[model samples]
Target chain A: MSSPERRTADGLERAQQLVRLKRYEQPDEGYFEGFLKEFQQRQRADLMQRSSRSLFCERLGTYLADFGGRRMLLAGGAACALALLFVRVAPEGQPVDAGFDAPRGEVTPVSAGPLFEGEIDLWEGMVVPAGDEEIDLPLFMVEPFDSRRAAGEPEIIEL
Target chain B: MADVKKRKPDEDRGLVERAKDGDTAAFDELVTKYSPKLYGLVYHMTSNHEDTNDLLQDIFAKAYRSLRRFRGRSAFYTWIYSISVNMTLNFLKKRNRHWKISLDDVDSAIEFDKEFIEQTSKTDPVRESNIHELQLRLNEAMMELSDDHRAVVTMFDIQGMPHNEIAKILKVSPGTVRSRLFYAHRQLQNHLEEFRR
Candidate 1:
């Protein structure tokens, strides 16, 4: 009995012998002549089998792989990112307009009187009126006037 | 010889460039150049004429479609050969083992092969009767191998590819290729022991 390594060597030698026999198996010479035609026919059939959308995508991908198309895609992406960045950062630095930026519904303008001269009673809240008129008003009406003054409105009025 | 070898690839590169530009004629020239060789590779692996024909067609079709992605990192020959091997292995995995082989006629020129002469001289009394049977048994023994082992044998022994070339094609190390060939030869030897007897 041969050692495993020796057996492997002998087997490889014999296998090489048999491999040579495989070369004997050959198609007719005519087969080679017709092979190109057959390949072309099959290629055409393959083309026909492909959907138009896939064909279009294949062509598009090929086009996009070129220098100009790649540059165009990069430029387009950069432009979109810059546009989005401007949109995000623009509103933060914009100046606030009192007339336009203020809330519109269910509110009116108010004004603040001289700060030290206004009454500051403990039981009654600080009373600051637009003018010297000490009109006796309900607490709810006074509350609205205070709220309008806090919101930086120019005058106090009933809605 | 070196000049001849160098010039061939340069010519192939030209054809490949034209084919990339959608020149069907340039591609047809490539098909003409490689089909016979590719046919031999697939046919020996499959042991079936019709299957080899169909597989060869599919391989070329795939190569043509994939030409745009071919970056010339490897020689065109090596690239196409890799494609042929991969597709054939995938095919063998899916194919039924019980399917019958459709071998083409052995060429008359084989009578002149040195190995054939040596084999016939050794088995002269039984050669005439045993040649076809022996060939069939050889193919059966090959089929009995694992797909990976069979690929190594087909590439190394039959196609005469180097270990490094086989490694590149199969994406394995050269050491792995050697081990696979060693094991495959041992298995084939066991399967065909009757011929030795």
Candidate 2:
């Protein structure tokens, strides 16, 4: 029996032999002669298929590379920097409210509920009225105001 | 007496320059010169004539479009061969999972090859009829390899490119190319074991 390395060498040699035989595989006659013409036709078709915009870009890139390799790159960089600076320093087109102290109209306090199960004067530090009887407030009176209503606007009660 | 000729490297360089400058005739000369060689490289990898033809057309078209960037860092031969290998590998990746083995007829001229004669002499006389079958099986075995290994094998074994040339075209070290070839050859041997005897 051949050694492992020797067996491998023999196998590789045989494989190479088989591969050498592959050179005999050739295309039909006149194939090579027509290949150039076919390639030209295909090249034309490809060119026609490409968009004019991409073709322009490709040509422009070639022109720039050939004309000013380093200077053009620096100029492009400077242009981009200037554009960014313009964007950064440009006016936002809106007034700036620096103090945030714009005058708002008077806001009436919204009462949470009766403090002592009866009528209480909210302005007098929760003092219940002396002659008023203890009356149960209606459920509707205790409900939270609808957000859809205008701010600081009092809701009209319908009897 | 026939005149002896020496191929000048500058000939291709001049053609490349002209092609870059939009001379289609010069580019046509390049296409005519390289297409047959590229066809072999692609056809071996694909194992299909129709695919090879379509791929060869696209490869040439791409090379033409990209000729402006051909910076002369490498030989035109090496550069174009690199393009062909890359495009073929990409094509194989996108090819159908159930790729069918389609081989062209093995040229009868191969019978004249010394290796072919010696191998045939050892095999049974009836083995002559099995050439087509053997070719099919070889292609199937080749298809079993990964695209990287297959590329190495196709370039080295079939195209007879030097390991360094394959390495340059593949952008890898010669050591890597040898390793890939070694593994690929082992796989092929196991696959084609029936013919070993």
Candidate 3:
């Protein structure tokens, strides 16, 4: 490798020196002042847009993208999943909410009168007390299915 | 010179430490100190001012965001410069080749520069070319070089950075830096032969 000083009179040196004119290419007057102000504005906007929590989460996400951190996260996730699977697979375990006193009798399906005629009986088979007027559930609001309207199968409703 | 050299990095280290501790003012100081230099680096590589300004902002923002991970293994100056050069190089790759060369106005002080007078005083083709024409031709010649070569030329020639510092910023060995400069200079000479009498 040759030093630039040792080749001052050569064409390479002249070309190198010519490029020195590039130093004069400064921005317009007051550009730096404007630049700094614009930068601060941008910084404040950035701060307003992204909270420290998001910044930390972004950094954490970046850190966890690396090999060691990814492996650690994967191990932790596997452990949590294993704990969940253990609890779920244990049939002898008590129901999750044992204290909530949900109704515990057989719920036989009930026959329904046509809706729209206002003869719908909602509490026919459910074991509510005879005068239990507190359960004021609305009847189904659809028109009765017509035998003449059974011409075509219903379109599959994509959930 | 040696004492000054030793003190600069220590000063930068103090600022960097403070900035890492969430001191926005410290980071602003760093930005104020390096923006002009990095602006030159990006502007010369791009031959466009708007792109340089945008890239400079992004470079500092990225540095501030990543400051916590900066481990002082390198000087803050070198680390920021590394980020600057790499970011500019990546940006150049994505920049459109057909984009217009929107140059910043040459500083008025160039008229009184001894080197500029000497350069323009010669009876060569360069002396016949006006400043605007010269700037265009020179930028065209530079843009002709490959991105890697152009980066080295911008650092070593235009910015007057030492080959070792450039090597540090570019993460290449000094020999590779020298090799790239050699070839880059050769290419520029061929393209800008008007500079030679």
Candidate 4:
């Protein structure tokens, strides 16, 4: 390991020397006053803009605790999970038939009156009645059928 | 010189104790005291005023946050510089490689260099060209060094921080600081050779 003194003749030393000398070089009194004012202005603006909390501390602490040097993998995993959830949770164009797979002893064929008239909740797998007034239908009117089989065969409704 | 040397150790210890106790005003005073020197270190490394300013804020904020963990392993100044250097290096890692150094007009070393040269020389063609050209070359050379190398060079060559202090700041041996400085200076010398006679 060489000392900076070894490179004293080097242009780097000269540049460093010039920079150091400039420190005490002292700007003209007017320039110094103006410089201090501007410097203070910048400092104040910077203080205002800076978050009260340190990003380096926040980011580094988060990375260490949550990501633990697997930031890419963790972030990728999170993104994939979000995407899958979106695909599953997003509303589909076609209304789902809740009566298709009613649990045993439950209504197998639940009619909401007219085709595609009402919305279905994929969450609870129930058909919601559309328009005004409640359409009276027995809870167990239709026999429950296998979803796979019901799906294979399209329902024929009478108006 | 004797007074500074005598005063430095006690002052460093007192500042560290106050900072550890969560006195923000004490820490701010420390920032005011050391910011100029650290600014030189950060500005030379980043070569961008906006980035340097941002990085400086982050560095101090980091030190303030991690004050509890500092543990008196090094002097307060060294510890803060360590935070400053590391934060700046990480920022450099994330910074766009294509972004050139945005030299500041307020404290440009090139202006000092030009003034120094005009005072010293009779007819030097190299330094005589538009100061703009020289500033560009010097800053470009500065921007080329790796972050670690640049930090050492910035602290040692540009800022005049001694190797022992740098070692303490970087949490390394003086030998390591010396080696980094040597290599960085060599690299910088090569880059700025055009400025030499």
Native-referenced TM-scores of chain A, all candidate models:
0.40, 0.43, 0.32, 0.20
Per-residue C-alpha lDDT of model 3 across residues A73-157, encoded as one tens digit per residue: 7899999999899778867856766557898889899779632232334335222334535444443543445444566766555
Error of 1 at B163 (Å): 1.1
Q: In candidate 3, what are the lDDT values of residues B1-197, reduced to their tens digit?
A: 23223535545888888887778888888888888888988888887777788999999888887787777888888898899889998999898877655444334455666767776776466677777767777888888999899999988888777777788889999999999999988889888876576
Per-model B-chain TM-score: 0.83, 0.85, 0.86, 0.80
* DockQ for each model: 0.25, 0.30, 0.30, 0.08
Docking model 2 quality class: acceptable
Worst 10 residues of 1 chain B by lDDT: B1-10
| Candidate 1: clashing pairs of residues | A109-A155, A110-A155, A110-A156
lDDT of 2 by residue, A1-159 (tens): 569879878877777666555655667679888777788787788789989999999888777766767998899999999979967776798545555888768999988984555444433334344457655555444544354364756776779
Q: Which 10-residue window of candidate 2 chain B scores lowest in summed lDDT?
A: B1-10
True contacts kept of each: 0.49, 0.52, 0.57, 0.11
Error of 3 at A43 (Å): 0.7
Q: Candidate 4, what DockQ?
A: 0.08
lDDT of 4 by residue, A1-159 (tens): 377655565565655543333333222335323433455466567668878676566657754644444777788899999979967885889544564875556558976886546765444445567877565555454344446555787666569
lDDT over C-alpha atoms for residue A111 of model 2: 85
| Cα lDDT of model 1 by residue, B45-163, tens digit | 88777789999999998899888878888778878989999999899988996766434433444556676767666753336455666677778887888888988887777766778
Per-residue lDDT of model 4, residues B1-197, tens digit only: 23223436445677767867766557666777777767777777776666776676667666666666666765676667777888888888888878765544334443555555564344364545655566566667667878888777766655666777777778889999888877776676787666655
Candidate 3 — which residues are off by over 4 angstroms?
A1-9, A51-53, A59-159, B1-8, B100-119, B122-125
